[model samples]
Target: MAAKKNILLIIADDLGRNLGVCGESKIKTPNLDDLAAQGTYFDMAFASTASCSGSRSVIQSGLHTHETGQLGLLRGFQGLHYFTTFDHVETSPKVFNSLGYLTGIINKVHVGPAECYPWRVREESSTRDVAWTAQRSAAFFERAKEEDKPFFLTVGYIDPHRDLTRGGFGNTQDYPGVEHLPYDPKDVTIPFFLSDVPEVRQELAEYYSAVWRMDQGVGMLLQELHRAGLDESTLVMFTSDNGPPFVNSKSTLYDAGVRLPMIIRTPGCTPGIVNPNLVSFIDILPTFLNWAGFANVKGNRKGRSVLSIMSETSPLDDWGQVFGSHTFHELTAYYPTRYMRTKRFKYHRNVAWQLDFPFPGDLYGAVSWEGMRNAEPAMIGKRPVANYIKRGPEELFDLENDPEEVHNLANDPEYNETLLDMRKALEAWQLETEDPWFFRDGISTRVIFNHIDAGMKMPDRWDFDVNSPGSKDGAIMPHSFKEVRGRGAM
Candidate 1:
């Protein structure tokens, strides 16, 4: 029998397709660049969903976002309706564990009901003494060496997301004078919210700094693997959960939200090959299973192994379309948007919110109903007013021309046929996935506000207080006082 390949999956949070290896000279990703040189780089790779939890769910289950229903961050008093990666498949760790391979996870594994530990996965960190990424990963590799068993390890890094205020590094205040990369702020184009400003530029610089720090962590893990003499046998895959946290990127269905950098390195496999074929995040699960010599594992996984493509045995002819979607963000708001991406064009459909009240802007919240407020122009109502007063119900962008998605071609007379085709495609996908939106109770604007109010009470450790005054439904903003703590109803 062939020796099982040791799998090391390293995932960076909110990393976009911006990297030195991807021909972007702005960012410094030497480790990733080197990995791409040794293995295959999937140029048009995309996440199943844009949000972290949603993307993670799809990656683990080998299912699409609509199929999994693990859309939003918080369940919003809905009590966690989404099916997670853990809820679907035999857990990734369990698969390796069953194979007698030492399996472990380091750092953020946010999936499924937080209160219930279904898979019995072990945590390498505690509240008081949180384990650093490199340290815990090195420890796992050491144990793998001692046991003489092939290992499947996942190291999750929380960097370049949104500095620590909302579960991020939160030390951007300290990292002053870090030079911004070559991507000009004026040309730092995105779909929605926030025009280029000094504050935005500074935030970008901090994000890059965090990326650099994450690279150090990767270096440490690689060094340890080299010392253990496992580098030759290990299959190292480096990727991110989703795109950068810029407006329409992180939580929406744009390319910036779904498109991610993926580098896979197998010692005996091909090197420095850039595969432009479209691939989904779900494909990782099957690829890993096949690499481990376990191709018949049972589950309702929806991805095919890309190992053939990686090995240069399969032709890189037109890969099929990749899909992405978004259901919920933060606590409030449920915008169900599905996307269909072929090599040339990308189509988006916002089924729930036909009139864009405040997309991208709503990410941080326009008013301070809860302790949530974004400093962006859209939130401040300072953006140039549009004639439509809202975005269209559906959107189609010719990615070949409008790579940044600055133009909406859905209503164009010339592209009417293309638009109809995409709509049918998206509808077919929704039906095939059996999406909850197809048969769920309507989600009202009021309910969304209530959830946001509830989230304010238990903001993540990194969140800052949004003290701005604003009203919801013309009602006075709720006050937070020491004596009235936990008294207000959500």
Candidate 2:
């Protein structure tokens, strides 16, 4: 058998399909572009959630937030959102380390309990300082070479996340070996998820600059890999934890939040192939396991390895829809949502639709939000202010025509069958995954733990009526009640 391959996993923070490889013309990501040229690019890769910590937890444990019990940030200081991984779960580093590989992580260390990820080399540096991070990685590479062991190194870049100061994506910093390629607000491409406002443009420009810095870091790492004579033997994978840190895109269940960029260069595999097979971050652990030659794959893992389809340029028939679950981003940003997305259609079931969705701290205070917050009726993106804050119980979008997700077809009778089928599939996935937030009337099944023995059976359909059993009183159902369970809903 061929010698076990070394794995270099580079995870960018808060980046979506904004790289040069993904056809973002304005932003410069040449290193990633080159990586794509020398590897396989996944056109439809997705993150389980849009939150940084929660998404990283999903990536690490190969389980959704619901399964892993990591609903939000690991900030115990605030008290409520201090969630962590389940003790029983095996993280990526743990699994790789078990296979006799020397594992290391440089830059941001968001997901942790420390015990779960027992990386041999843990260098937490500022991801904004790409040159510095690359230097640390180069040293790690050299050490791995000297150790004569297959290594699993994760380079987590903090670039592209919202900066502490509003409208700054690390452009003001002075990195010795990095070029400050700040984008012009006039040249930046405004995503449909955001409104065409000057503030949005300015923030995007900074975000682009940060991304450029990250690209430089990627180049440095690749150069180091080549210098160590490990280029051909290393399996280099580049991806991000979540989407952009913009409001309506990061925390929301829309495609802008979950759809991500994924480029993987496997040793001796076909180069420069753009594969369209639907893939998820959950599949990453299994892929790593497969690479490490693990025979008995763990049973608790929820994803299939895409090793077979990595080389093939065509999409697979079996690669159907992907599912996602999000409980919260922060303690107060509690919006339990579940979704199932196919190539043509997308369905979302917002469990806590009655409660107005809370914003992430960074986004709330961003320059991008200035237009939305002060605009007439508090606008967010292109949607109505009220619609943006308060979501409907169910959302169905025809992605074939409305890729931007501007139009909601949940109420339209024309696509009733599509809505019903997608909803059914989403529900089936919920049951399969044992998602706890899949409760009727938005009454969290977790809360019913005390009442389960008292004949409080989990209802198939939630009763939106305030007077009904388990129904949350004084809560407004955003959508019309015509398609509810007893009315005409599937």
Candidate 3:
């Protein structure tokens, strides 16, 4: 048999499909564009969740946020530790290591319990120093070459994630000999998810600057790989954890948030093909394993390898729809939502429709959001302020006509069938996944089971507070600290 192919999976933080190859004229990404030209660029790739850690966890584990229990960030201030990964979970690194491939990761190690992800080479940092990272990766590549073993190196960059300031995207730093082609606010194209206010324009300009730097990083890494003569033997994949780091995009279930840029350059595969299949981050684990000649690596995962579809230029019949589950952004931002998106319709089921949508810390403090929030009635581009925050239980959008998702067709008489069908699909998925927060009558079914599992009497009306017993209505509230603590309902 031929030599096993190596893997280099580069994940960009908080980046959307706004690259030059993806038809965005504002930013310059020649290296990534060239890669797209020399590889297969996927148009409809998406993330299971929009948050950083949760999305990364999904990609690594081939499991949804609900399944992995990494529903939010690993940061402590948020008290979202309840959603952290359990020890029993299997990760890509674990499988790769067991298969005798030298697994390594450089920078931004966000997801984990340490034991689950046993990467042989773990260089963790949160800096956006791309050149420095490339040098470090070069050292790792040299080591891999010396070892004579096929390697799996994951390079996670901190580019394009929001900086400390509202309008900064890590552009102030000066890297050696790196030409920072600055973006003009006037020249930047505004995405539909945000209003075209001065603040938004300014922020987008900074964002473009960060994206440019990230593209430079990509160029440097690819150059290093070619120099080491590992380019052809490697299956290189470039993608992002989630969407852009802007309000209504990063934490939302909309395409602007979950939809990402995915380009794969597999060894001996046809290049420059655009596949518009509905693929997700979860599909990546299987693809990596399959490409590494370990297709049957032991793991129970929801994703399947897309190696067959990677070379296809036209859309495939089986690649029709995708599902998304986002429970929390922060522990405080408890908006349990699920979605089923097809070519024409996108359906969203917001479980806690009665409560107003919570804002992420970064988005809440953003000047762009301030501009829209202080506007007449505060509109997110064309969407109403009320619609942005206070959503109903169900929402359906005809993406073919209303690509911006500004119009809701859930209540429309013409779309009742579509709405019902999508709702049923989402409900069936929730049941299959055994989601703890599968809301029935504002009550989590798993919480009801908690009582049964605990050997406590099942409430007749299901009207006992999980918090204070006999307080009426055994509701499992996420933000209610006392409730979740007393009831042990995550």
Candidate 4:
């Protein structure tokens, strides 16, 4: 029989496509670049949400934020307590532990309920010190070796993330072997998502330095793995919780936010293959469970493992679309938006488009934000601040043509057929996932199902009033998901 493979999942905080392998040559990421070369690099991977705690929760629970009940940051978002997954949601740690893997997390476990994530070794260090994390992870590996058990260790590096202060990125301290000054403000490429200003450039410089330190940490961990004679038996995956900490990124669900990197070095797989599969954070748990021999995968874990097609160069039939769900970032940033992104088109349903979008605590006070707000153009990249904050209820974008998502074609008669098709597909997904955000007449269908079951006639148009769209020719009746699940929604 083959030896069971160990899992080393390294999650970088607030990192975007800054690595060279991801086509960002300005911000050097040698460790990640080499790791991508050593295994399959998924080109189109996404997070269920764009916030830190919410994304990590999705990674662990293998479910969307709507299903997991992680509506916002899990803890200490501006010293205000937030929420976590329900106790019933089985987290990655809990599953791997019960299935006989020695589960341990080195830093930044932003999930909840001890029973859900019963980590055998949990070190809740919020340190950006990579060496300490590397040493701790190695020690955990040694313990697993000592007990003759396969292991699952997560090294959550808090580098490249914003510090408590407005423009800080935890880069004030000198590291042992990392380059103290990785890049200059003029050298680092300003992402298309941010404005070109002094504050934004300087912040990117600091952010680059922090990412450099995090890469050093990655190199150290890989070195430890090699030294411990576990290189051939371990599956190493490197990913980020969300996009970079920028004004237009991080907390929003644009491609800059929800779309992130997924690099995996599975044992005995063909190296240097670029898999174009559309994957998600929810797939992580299923992949681990697949490695750990846990079967009977059903219910709310609405994701399949990437193990079957990790090295496939071309996109598969079923790997073409992904869903995104977001409710809040802090306790206050409650702009609920759900999206369905296919290979070419993206559709968004902004549940709270009536209210202005709230910014996360850090982004609100960011220097980049301040610069853009006061700039002559007053833009976050090419997007107007007004259009960003006050979004439309429905939006449709042709990602192949408008990669930046600058245009909304929902109301355009030319794309009406395409828009309705994508909307139906998204609604069908909501029904299958039991998403509570599926609305009718400004109310959750699930929330008002009792009234519907008791024969309350309702306007069938989505979340509309009397004079709104499709209210005149209303398909008014008692609602049923089985009836509403539209055709071609497969």
Candidate 5:
């Protein structure tokens, strides 16, 4: 005879594991620390994509970014809506609204096409006023009580994110209630991927200030839930959209970009368990579905519910790998990349490797980038400026040996078998996901299915070889996209 459980999902924009719980950050996130102390802190949770809208859409849809059609930013810095979630997609808000729950989103509605989300109380804005957001959340809880229905509320806090420029992270505004916890540039912890330069530290200090502000928002949002007397019956989760809004972290497919901090507080679960299970952002919607008593009725979602393993403290054999896709960040930042990350290895298949990787508009304008650009020979963290810019088509990294992913083992003869095995495994995943980026000879094989069926001979190589292109005899015919997409073939 238990009451129906409510769900509160708080998404922090452009955040990383720079908190007290991670024990790696100099930034003090007391509220998050308190939450992790009473919740399951996932050690290996990852984002489906490193871009904002792509990752958030995966979170809401329980599908990969490629499947959701939310390929990049729905709203850019200039207030333009570009890549939105398709109308055909069944997002979490739509799903919960279809059920009996009252769904509402306050602050930062990154995923869009209003018809697709169908939020009952959608007040989407980028106001950095934490107090106002908390006030709205309190009103939402009261309204849900008045309507006599269980609720699902998403409080999107835009903090720790880069401002319109890179000079500061959303830290210029003054608020009446939130405390001003300014970080000293010298004391902040420098990310391993990014640099140890003074300019990066200055930006990190500003980023820490923004994080403090965002932590205040979390503290405020949770206070409202407690004041509403809905504490014990609510499943609260705190996480970020992607990684930190830095050069190498935000829009890239490396571990610094995709690996994120995840903390979930579920009712009736034992508190303070540090779970090491490899979870994906896509798993969140399925977790919500399982929480709403609809686990048996899942559709084409690609993730399993993490609710069953919230208390686990060690990595499970089955949950040892994750996959990701990143095609765009803004409307113009197009560099199609897909990856398969196992427990110890990561394989990146950059389809458009010919084009130099694009920078996010905001990151490009940041003061940090300016400093790096002016350096005698610019570099990003441990990587050289040239290495970070122009990349090879395939990259394989043994994460255990090279945690920074600076060393590419794709071409190394010592790991030839490992390289081949990873490539085949990644291709199989691309087949399973029906990714259009599956290429052969510089062309997407998905689009050439008809020509392939018409008996046009093609090379078996991933990319077209200029030295010896013709493969009339050795060409291995691949299955059609229709067959593979329908789960009929692999």
Candidate 6:
């Protein structure tokens, strides 16, 4: 048998199909471009969820976001009752650790609220400093070499995730020469829903700068691997946790929120191949396990191994449908939205309330960390909130025609059959995965406040109405009708 391959999975935060290899001309991602040239790139790959916690949950568990019950980004929510990626359940990493592989994680390893199991070793560190990503990753590899064990190393980079409250690139200075890149707001393409204002353009520029910095980090790590004589033996994979962080991107069920860039480089394996088959983030766990030769690690992981597809030995019939969803954010009760994507189309089903501001009354959405405080005053009233509350119960898009998801065709009489077929498939998947939202009660609630009170008098026009489902007061209430469940307490 061939010597066991070492696995290195590198994840970038909030990345999309906007890389140079993906035909994006404005951004500079040469490092990733080179990696894609040497590896197999999946053009239709998608994240199981849009937010950090949700997508990470899928990566660790090999289960859909609904299956893990971690559909939202909140630290604590109703989804905790189910199994997680790190749980001692059948699909835990212990299966691989038991097989004599040393598994270690660096940077953001948000694998749910479950306490760390005894199987895997984790080197926790702050990834805010982009320079440390490669350095720390190299350190982990050196440790693995000393132990003389084949390893699975996961490196998480927080770059390109929206910058801190300042709005500039977080670690761009570390990747010198990034500033020299063409910073043209005109080159930035705003999403269909968001206005193409100067503020949005400036935000895109900063976002591109961060992407350039992350590419530098990748180059640094690849150099270290090659220097240590591990490049040929290591199976390196580069991907993103979710899509870009924008108004209709991260939290929505649209393609912009879930589609990710996935590249895998294996020695003596196929190179420079692009597979347009549908692949989900949930497949990562099983793919890693299968590649490590632990085909039956523990339980039945939900994903199929893409190794066959990567090698070009398997036919296209082996590929299957992919699903994604989202639940919580800020302190608002955004309705749960689930998605089912095939090769040519994507269907989004909005369960619970169909509010316009999906996460209404959530303080975080209003406060754009970069010192911009709810600049749009028109979004603070009842009509807007109510309108958001009554949005589409279902939405469908033809990827070939409307890749940007500009129009919703679920209600169109011509495509009723397609909508029904997708909905049926979505319902079946939810039922099989045992999603909690399928059994939940009435719509979730979120309480908005007029003014935060640090140490001053409450707002004079404070309004309170229990029956209205949403309130504007000094304190924001949880979305639950009975009582707020987890974490967010007034």
TM-score of each: 0.76, 0.91, 0.91, 0.94, 0.95, 0.79
| Least accurate 10 contiguous residues by lDDT in model 2 | 481-490
Which regions of candidate 1 are displaced past 4 Å? 74-89, 114-121, 124-131, 164-169, 172-194, 311-318, 355-389, 439-490
User: How does each model score on lDDT?
Assistant: 0.64, 0.81, 0.84, 0.85, 0.86, 0.67
Off by over 4 Å in 4: 464-490
For residues 1-490, write the lDDT of model 6, one tens digit per residue. 5686788889888887779888888888999999998989888788877777668767777877656656556343334333233344443445567778888777766565535333266766545555576777788778778888888887888777765443455644444333335477778865543444566677778778788878888888898888777987788889998777765566666777788799999887777888878888878888888888777764646787788788552337557578877765433545677889987778987765435545422224323222222345332111232233355767788878877665678889998999999987887676565455542224222121112212222222212224654323433322122322332422
lDDT (Cα, tens digit) per residue for candidate 1, span 329-437: 6545467777889887888766564445334332343122111123332331123335123556678889888776657898899989999888778766655554444
For all predictions, the C-alpha RMSD in Å is: 12.2, 5.8, 5.0, 3.5, 2.3, 10.5
Report the lDDT of model 5 for residue 95: 89
lDDT of 3 by residue, 367-458 (tens): 88988888876899788988888888888999999998889998999999999899878877776776776764446766665554444433
Q: Taking the tens digit of each residue's C-alpha lDDT, what string does model 5 give over 220-322?
A: 9899999999998899999998889889889999999988889999777888888887899989999988887889757788789999999898889999888
Which ten residues in a row are the worst by lDDT in model 3? 475-484
List residue ranges in candidate 5 displaced over 4 A: 79-81, 453-456, 466-471, 474-476, 480-490
| RMSD versus native structure for model 1 | 12.2
Clashes of 1: 5
**Model 1 TM-score, all chains together:** 0.76
The CA root-mean-square deviation of candidate 2, after full C-alpha superposition on the true structure, stands at 5.8
lDDT of 4 by residue, 192-268 (tens): 88889888998899899988888989999999998888998898989999999887789889999988989989778
Evaluated against the true structure, the overall lDDT of model 3 is 0.84
- Clashing pairs in model 1, backbone N/Cα/C closer than 3 A: 164-168, 164-169, 164-170, 165-462, 165-463
Evaluated with lDDT, which candidate comes out highest?
5
Clashing pairs in 4: 441-463, 442-463
Going through the candidates in order, what is the number of backbone clashes in each?
A: 5, 1, 3, 2, 4, 6
**TM-score, model 2 to reference:** 0.91
Cα deviation at 159, candidate 5, in Å, is 0.4
